[model samples]
Target chain A: MVERHEVRLSGSGGQGMLLAGIILAEAAILADKNAVQSQSYGPEARGGASRSEVVISNTDIDYPKVTQPEIFMALTQEAYNKYHHDLGPNALLVVDESLSLTDDLPEKSRVVRVPIIESATETLKRPIVANIVALGVLVGASSIVEHEFIEKAVLNRVPRGTEELNRRALDLGFQLAAGAVGGNK
Target chain B: MSPTVKLLQGNEACVEGALAAGVKFFAGYPITPSTEIAELLAERLPLVGGRFMQMEDEIASMAAVIGASLTGTKAMTATSGPGFSLKQENLGFAIFTEIPCVVVNVMRGGPSTGLPTSPAQGDVMQARWGTHGDHPVIAVYPASVPEAYELTIKAFNLSEKYRTPVIMLMDEVVGHMREKVELPDVPQIPIEERPRPTVSKENYLPYDNNQGDVPPLANFGDGYHFHVTGLTHDQTGFPTSAPAKAKVLYERLHRKIENNLDDILMWETKDMEDAEIGVLAYGSTARSAARAVSLAREQGIKAGLMRPITIWPFPEKLITQYASQLKSLVVAEMNLGQYVNEVERAAQGQVPIKRVLQANGELIRPDTILQAIMEVK
Candidate 1:
């Protein structure tokens, strides 16, 4: 298992990528690890590209920004084209199945095309929970954080009375990732 | 026993710290990077019977804070670069009147609204001299989210104890980042309140120096009718243009903080006991400096870091002491060069001082700092 992992989640403004980053960081803290989450977005309230980065470490974390991400997940084609080249060596590039991969992908990075948005829309029938679905997929594929802690964090953040909906969305996400990778650790 | 650990954003930690420090009033305008400080306080303050006001503008927010503080309430206002610029006039007013309030400037890139979403340390000089006149200032910068929590409490403490407006300088990175914070219990947190008048209301002198450098400040409504203004005032709290009285008031304002340097100055040193090169940094840049110092040590170059938690009255003595011992020094910050000049003055040409600066809305990376460290002969 990687002792220090940097994860970046990028999409449009309304996609909830920031909340996903927060949940991931909260999960890391719940497991007694150190984590830092930060984000950047344009001036618009929605539709503009947004990115949130989380760094998880067993030891102290210095230089809070993500320099080289070990895990990169992009839900939009614009975000994918902009950031997929900045991954670390032997890193995992997770993107939604909706995005078409370019030939110039990083040489040593592995690409996992999971149906992140589709799982939220078709399987869970709640398009807003796509960020949580993406979180499930990323954690399911990389095992950077435990599923139980992520579940607790997701439950802690979601709106009241929507816990059951988000739980199913997270579970569907895990299933999609497992199907793509043959099994989850 | 286990401590209460929660994953908190830097802004959230600041709110927690303010609430813990007996802050009863918050008046601020919503601005990027620092808006969360106001947002969280707005939601949290009312629940605790504290008042949170979304003022008309940054100036009004500052005025409201000073107004609230005069009533013996611990008040604060948070803003970014543009709003920080707007608050300067009233900030000077608070300083001139010796009102106890905290102004949190979560710094972003700028002379204007340079980068709303990015971090910069451009306000180091502004925090000291942004407001006009030759006056003493106390500004503290924290590098991490946990430190943000701890330092917010310290800001309120210093403000109340000195009866001045204390500036809490936070870069956008520290304001927006999230970290796990092990919060202390209510009983464990130390709180300080402003000293109140012991004499009768008729005999009360708001700016009495005979009592001490920081006299007992009587609240406006607490049976003490004292006058406050931006003009220079004497011990009786009335406007006085006389040179002697003006000189005495000005000197006391500076001396109150300068004389209490032992209590006001807070800093931390790492790997400095036996080092040839010293790096002086603060806020988010200090975190990068720490990594660079460690990397330099691993490369067999003796390097150390002196991070000032309090930046304003300037850590002159500490910087001078380190300058004498080290062969060279490096001043790293997000701005092109603000506090570096202060470091140079304190060093007094004792050693060569190098600078690592960036102002394009990005952090100064550790490797960039390490490269500078490698170049120092």
Candidate 2:
């Protein structure tokens, strides 16, 4: 059985959705699985909603984009509403609880409300790293890539000493992932 | 002089590679998506004693490239969609006369005046059949910055190797993206120049295949003064209506590429061994497809991606090999369905071939591909 998986992260541009996709893709590649990552935003750079998708496969991937995602992560109400109808029948969705989204979800789909923005602010004292918090939830949902690989990918991408803050955020993410996976005791 | 790689935009890399490949002449009209190629070349060529001129328009730019190439100098030109349309007639001339030159088409959206600043793979078939006629053309596409550099060098080699017009079908993303590209050392890149005939003016058959599939070209002032035209011709450089001679010349021109398919064909494959579903894409679109295949595999779906680095001549052999095991094949391109026909035809009746197409002047994103895969999933 081939392992084909996609993770889509949507939020306002500065929420680091694109960077999260890169980190995930890099982690998958570090795991030696075939991976592809891409992102986009509107004419606006900072405030406009941005989206990113990543694919990880045991074999070669044909279509690059995620037409339908099995797991979706949204950081803002606009992103949550934008991609609400795109969630597959059995897809898993992770969205910020603080964002007011009132849409009805598909029957086979499951929505997880996480305090991503609040959590990022509380732990790292910044709202920007909420993507990593959401990404932690994705790792909990789908073990597509190893968390250790993600840590190394983060270290490899960020500047020399920014690791301390990222490590704190990543440790919290590890806890979140464990929680999502039922504490895997 | 240095053995380093810099992640460069496709256009920047092409200019650097073109100059290093002994290209001393450049003439182009600046159009969106491809202007950086000319801009870089304009700045750098003069430093290397190369001639770089901005022509009045695309038609003149193409003509200037041909004119410079005929004089035994490695020459080139670049343009986007409408500029490519303007160069079609002369492109046919390059095919008929077998002039060795490279044309870089940094593809943008449209048939007429489409999205100028946007990216599109709409020119795949246009690069194949854009110039009206049954003549041979060599086309290559680069998915990333490094390949863009490597392939631009290869394009010059193919042009000189076969004495035909070679095209680099780079899109806006590759053309503009600036990354950390480690440029390779000069000695590492084995350069090949065109075979120039040593035979005197009296006995030179400009269309002769006996001198190899490509006859050694003699520059205009090389004491081998011979005529080159776009009409049907015989062995001598003169135009002729003789059917047998016309047939012979036509067959050889086509064979230079056909016979070298093994060497000319380039592609990349992902998870194809047991893939029930296959995606066939080229250029910028393939970047997304490569990721989607991996995602599909994680979800317990058997999928693989096939991206053609060489878009023309359509990698039929490669496609046929994967087509046998696939339940369905998808051809995703920027335009409506131009290249999808070739993919469908290559698959024969073996499986269902479909197109997940887009043309609203936007790059085909990863989400659209996930939707298509789930349809089959």
Candidate 3:
């Protein structure tokens, strides 16, 4: 429970990153921490780059937007390429296996390569649940929010009939991250 | 469904606040950054036995709200920049006719659809004088989601008490940003209704300037026949070309708000007890100013914040009080220089003023304001 923690979820337009950011904020609220979520997207309804930032703090948050993220999740290569440069000290960089970093690293932060999409599509048997899996990895890797709080948030937000599927997807995220290098940062 | 805490966007908060204040009718055409207000109201209004209408255009939407308000229904309309421009004539009509209604402008980058999805505070001046002629206006701006919820209720209450159209001037940042909010119980919050006629129908005058500045408005179907028009009228609501009557009636319209400045003004000040530099801001810019003030204080600089929860009838007297004490003032907004004009007029050359302005649809950052604070003496 640091004084303030900034988390960003970045991916393509249809990746549901905004909802992931929202769930994270709600989880922080469940933990009795103040949280604010802000997002931006391109004009196109799909395939365009989208990013959502969640700032969780013990005190009131004045500047809602994230200037430097302590935890950054890049669900797509373009997202990784755009946001990888700006990292807080010893930041945790979570990227899906489909994207590779061709650029130099900042040396201060740690990187976790997880198969977020592959877990959702092949293992969970539902690609649309990828965002929930990504959320699980975010919690496991950074411990920014609790798993139980996130589970409650997911159940509160997900569609009515797919609660069990999203819950399993979240568990799969934690399992995938448990085996990841430097998972428990 | 009780009054529990929930995560809501600023637009959703506006609807919640309006409903809490007893808003029964919403007439609005969907527009970007503000469509959520209409959407949420459409769903919630019907459930609460209220009516929601998606009007043909912004003009028709404004007219519809006024029409509903005349029938004693608490009504509101939400729009954005171009739509706000379209709403001005009828907004003026509401002002002169002394109809009470809430008009929300979730401002986007503007002039003409400047930026649909981006944030801007370009509507500050437009909210004050968008409609033509000399009339009274009370526009309130909220810096965050909770204030958006609270001030919308206040907007409705003010419109009812003063018998004028109240504007909830919001920006895209506040409108679109999501945050957790704890709403109060509906029964716990106070609600105001438009004052009904105290005298008999024979003695009732819709524009009765003789009794007091704000005459009691009898609802259209409340067994009282009264004429309400956009044109200047006297005791009875009829077109009048008489100079003496026009002068008295027009002055009362202005005097009603101008005379009640203390009752209408709402502002927030922080760390102003012993600060040499003051930051004056409203809307989303105030959030950044709050951060910059704390950051400057950490660096041992004397900086404080003055935020206006109510923007129009611009908090000039309070600004003047701070202007005399502070060495300089910094006005930050998303627009180039909309509200700065009033800040300067209130400062009256008593203190030097600096501006941190942006119109590129990006928010004015905290570090930018902190740098301005460091630059000034």
Candidate 4:
């Protein structure tokens, strides 16, 4: 039996952080891999720190708690500051540049800053899509989920008629994360 | 073969389990930690043509289930700490009145609204004592989503089989986390339903002795002239305060579960072959303790785990059997020494029983059990 990989997503309450986690876990489940998704949220719906964790495995995961995160994503200053310390040297850390991060980076940890918020508002015209954009970056770095599978899962989760906007958000993230956003080549 | 085992939260599996059990009636209020139970049930129960209602309060929700149960339907209700407390009086009514129903308590951290959304195994004692009196009850503590699904079906079967209430006890962790659960074909599962009365109204005795410990119940106003009362009663079902009659009724009520102890008690044991120390636990905490015992063994320590799948009726017999082999027993629970005390008493001084307890609005993890296991010396 293959081991399961753990992923943790962190952001402010209203940033659709939890939705991002759901989409990724759904992708794994859709891919026929053993997956578990769980969240820890505060009482406040907005402006509060909200977080979600997903476990992708080849075998059954005995416990849902994530003591070690193989991949971590933080979308806000508070989220980054709170979870950045928990990142081990081998962990992948994804950050949203719109939210400033002053925390000293973990030694040898891969830190990728995607303009998730700016792209969500300017390109997608919806700040809520910031999570989707970050999910693209997540899929790019982790290679744990097929990009098409994650897109389809997001479409299934979002409200009908908003699929076009969500799809565009996905395209933006995919392009940016693949180093195709600004003709970086 | 089981479906691709994608992880699902315990609450979600329960919704599917209830559907598989052929449960057709659900009425409940949303309580933190347990809300997912209602949420999932609400979504699925309707698809199966079952009735799911969010009542005004927990009291009415409990009452609604009894009313539904009277209609010859498999009725169920789910709640958390305070809601469980509120449903006690009517639950007593259920026991006295012999209403076979299922109640799921996804326990959260609590004394009273202690922690709204956090997990804790603190309600093991509550499930037993929430309703007053010496009446019989069934409590199934599931450690995983699959067990949640299978035991939920068992809860309904036992409730209908013995004509009493069955409690599906879930704590924060099991209630929320998703795990892969394999569902069996519904027809393959053994389902128990209440025996309907065949006697004519004029000759009917609701509490007839011929029915044995389990009396056949006739729906109210079904032309069966049988008396039902909360007060102490005789076999005629009429309220009687007579000492002899009350004693017989009380003994019969308790005997249904106690006398049939072997059939009612369900427990799981692991690594007990040559163990020096055993960890006794139930509910979600039991799940972690099982793994920790394996870890202890890997480190060259002899540790075993005894889990009470049936939390009530205490499973005092099994605990008594392992009395001699136990070097030091540690009881780890989500609450403060509830089931721990039962182990201590069952140990009977042949061996010492220690307690490793936590009710800090969080789940008891494996490391916590390992720590307690190391302290067992």
Better of 2 and 4 by TM-score: 4
Candidate 2 C-alpha lDDT tens digits along B139-179: 99988766787888889998898899999998876676443
**Tens digit of per-residue lDDT, candidate 4, span B1-377:** 54544456788888777888888999999988888888888888788888999999999999999999887889999999899999999999888888889999998888797887788877778888888887777898898877888888888988988889898999877888766666655435687788777877787777777778888887776677666678888888889999998998888888888888888889999888788899888767776787689779889999998988988888988788888988888788888778778778878898888778887877677888888889874
Error of 1 at A75 (Å): 1.5
Positional deviation of residue B117's Cα in model 1 after best superposition, in angstroms: 1.6
Comparing 2 with 3 on lDDT, the higher-scoring candidate is: 3
lDDT against the true structure, per candidate, is 0.89, 0.79, 0.89, 0.82
Residue lDDT tens for model 1, B55-136: 9999999999999999888899999988998999999999999999999999998878788888999888889899999889
Pick by DockQ: which candidate is best?
3
Ranking by TM-score: 3, 1, 4, 2
Candidate 1 regions with alpha-carbon error over 4 angstroms? A182-185, B1-3
Better of 1 and 4 by lDDT: 1
Higher-scoring candidate on lDDT, 1 or 2: 1
Clash total of candidate 3: 0
Q: Kindly report which residue stretches of model 3 are placed more than 4 angstroms away from their true locations once superposed.
A: A183-185
**Order of models, best lDDT first:** 3, 1, 4, 2
- Give per-residue CA lDDT, model 3, range B1-377, as digits (tens): 56678888999999999999999999989998899999999999999989999989999999999999999999999999999999999999999999999999999988896899989999888888889999879999999998899999999999999999999998888998998899877535578777778899988999876667788999898888888887788788988989998998889889999999998999999999998999998888899999999999999999999998888898988787788899889989998888888999888999999999888989899999999999995
Under CAPRI classification, how is model 2 graded? incorrect
Calculate the i-RMS of every candidate, to one decimal place: 1.1, 6.0, 0.9, 2.3
**Candidate 4 wrong stretches, greater than 4 Å:** A102-106, A146-152, A161-168, A180-185, B1-7, B40-47, B183-188
Q: What TM-score does the predicted chain A of each candidate obtain versus native chain A?
A: 0.93, 0.88, 0.93, 0.89
Worst ten in a row by lDDT for model 1 chain A:
A176-185
